[model samples]
Target chain A: MAPLEPWEKVLISADFTQSIHGRAGCVACHRGQQSPDKDTAHVGLIPDPSQDAQRVCGVCHGEIVDGFGTSLHASLQGYRTIVYSRSVPENHPALDTAMQNHCLSCHTTCGDCHISQPKPVGGGLLNGHNVEKTPSMTRVCTACHGSRVGAEYLGKHEGIPGDVHFREGRMNCMACHAGTDLHAAEGDAAKHRYWGDQQPACKDCHAQVGRADDPIPQHTIHGNKLACQVCHAVEYTSCDGCHVAISEKTGNPFFKTEATYLSFVIGHNPWPSRERPYEYVVLRHAPVAPTTFEYYGENLLPNFGLLPTWTYATPHNIQRQTPQNRSCNTCHGNAALFLTADKVKSEELEANRRVIVENIPAAIPIP
Target chain B: MRRVGMLLLILGVGVFLGACASQGISTPTPVPTAPLPEAVLTPLSQTDYCVQCHTDKEALIETAKPEEKAPSESEGVG
Candidate 1:
């Protein structure tokens, strides 16, 4: 195990009584701290204070908590959908155990987003146990979602600068992914991560950027048909495929194989939510293969065709102008910019056939 | 002896010139790769005890969840 970073170390001795959360006192939210004896006080204490957030934070934050139950963060429907679609029975004991062991940590509780360090990435004090209205992105948001979005947005990615919004505007997650937006989802009904109007959109802030310029004719011509990310987002990482299996030797869950791709392409939008009603959007190849769950049981994902691996994606590496958007020929005739037959595997061809752009148009550079 | 000495000097000059030529052309500096992620040593949540029995759990390992070999007497803190 690696030595703990300065921030990863938990600050158990911090004075929590002076903070807003302190008004209720430690035992108010954490009921097990009654006796004042170290062991007795710790007894029956909830390990994750957020797990009991309804009783803790809900008293004051009722509305947020109400919507949060169905929010993407709480429901984790995206991960659940993957497990469900992979042929795992909903009520299977193994499924709960698998989630509790692996996926449960990623689920956000109030403290996760606001007070403490996120456990999925590693836990520590976000701000010396001081409750924060706006949590630090480095300490919170990116801790879990860091691989792609965090790297691109913060410009931590090798050979790529951070997102312009983050670089110049100094916009963190809350600038776009506001608490209201995150907490407004109808829980599990939102289905996919991008299935609702609650998710952030470039239009929310950049509603006029598309209409501002006359230099690019394609911007106007393709505005409604193409998502802003298709042209604005630079090359971002994509996990090619993932194979999940339990180790026979250890009885532990493990991924047998996973690979990443650092590039971008446009594909048909699989889910056109009200916020992103576009025919074409950027697509990132998901890390899911036909044999992803073979170790769990044979034919685990028999209906894998129900979901396309080349799903709609919004890579965070954004530029006002991109390589393909700058030249008509670069995107128009470029079969590489669009998901096509050759890009997909034979097994996924049937599922992704409808999503691949059919014909590539020859481009004449605008004089 | 002088002739042999002259040849030796010429050979030494040739070697020096070869060294200079090699130095004149800049070799590309290898880009430093980012350090690998350190194994997480501490649990994100201080109270998590799932790994006590589920030792092979990868997420717990990565997140630094604590593992208890014997049954924990600590109550209240789940």
Candidate 2:
């Protein structure tokens, strides 16, 4: 910042010559350099920071620009959201914003919704202005999510004895992760299947034998013997502590799978594990066929955040207004309870009844 | 009596069609929340801070042995 030496001034002017607008000094953008008293908010995810920076990128990286713009989500900023809509007067109901959350989340960039940056904190929301892309965004993702998901959802399991992707396919996570919408709903809301949907009972998936109308209870038979993590998980290396679990550059998990399968399984769902009525089933495997019990152990692992609070506000979980646990019967009502399977008739599981999960739990069979 | 019923019917339809719900919009009603969610700022613990990227090694998976699947021997899986 001090006056450059004569040779240094030559270099600084040479650096300035590289710019399209050579008249304005670098101080135009780096105003903080002008005076220690001023520091600009280094925020990213802003609207059209000097059109040249935001809109003119197509001149350089045409394809990346087009892809990001066509992605639809690229246009999310400077938009009205649900909160603004709700504030509308009752007399003027057709406000600009739609109440649906699907479109609204994009309006608030990923960093805004989660209240942090994507990778290594995306330079913090207020400080992300002049950043280029980095491998860290995915790390930011796993920062919020955890490694077990990579293993459980994508089939990248470390505990599978030999790592499958490592052995032959050399699969990298980007192979499966170049997507954003992870909702099982597949954009169809009729099933209301969201990654975050709360289901009173997973009986829909875990019970050995349940019709759509039956309560998904903990499997009372041998089905419970297997740990849920054994089947329902895939990649956890990135989640082990870093992101980009299996780097495409180097097709290996950042944290190699260390435990044997039996060890991993036992560590998670201990055989003869406590059979108490579990209200929370955070991670479980997808139910196996024929019997189709949506038992609690379907894809369980990770050893943390299994408490009621973590599962709260999840779409499948009935959302309580507050984070505090509502009474067990708030949604269950007297006729049916939250743990449909636990509350199921002993005869129901023995017989393997049919179940239907609506806002309420009721057995089928028009009896 | 029939004429009176007809008069009431016409009045009812007028109110239904001409009147709007507070706002001119006619929409389905929203359900009630048992209790409203209050917002509180929670501080992140260091381990939780670390969990932002890495899978928390301490995640708990719940599995149980059904009476049916109980092994004859209780030996742990090696």
Q: On a 0 to 100 scale, what is the lDDT of residue B75 in model 2?
A: 20
lDDT of candidate 1 over B3-66, digit per residue (tens): 9999999999999999999889688899989999989856344643322212223432454445
Segments in model 1 whose C-alpha atoms lie over 4 Å from true places: A1-15, A34-37, A82-101, A187-189, A210-216, A248-251, A365-367, B1-78
Q: Write the per-residue lDDT of candidate 1 for residues A64-160, one digit (tens) a residue.
A: 8777877768877777776676554643554555556545657888888787777765566565556888978877887777887888898876787
User: Stretches of candidate 2 above 4 Å error?
Assistant: A1-138, A147-163, A166-170, A179-340, A343-367, B1-78
The 10-residue segment with the lowest total lDDT in model 2 chain B: B56-65
Give the TM-score (vs. native) of candidate 1.
0.75
Q: How accurate is candidate 1 locally (lDDT)?
A: 0.69
Point to the candidate with the largest lDDT: 1
- Model-by-model lDDT, in order? 0.69, 0.28
Candidate 2 interface RMSD (Å): 24.4
Q: What DockQ does every candidate get? A: 0.01, 0.00
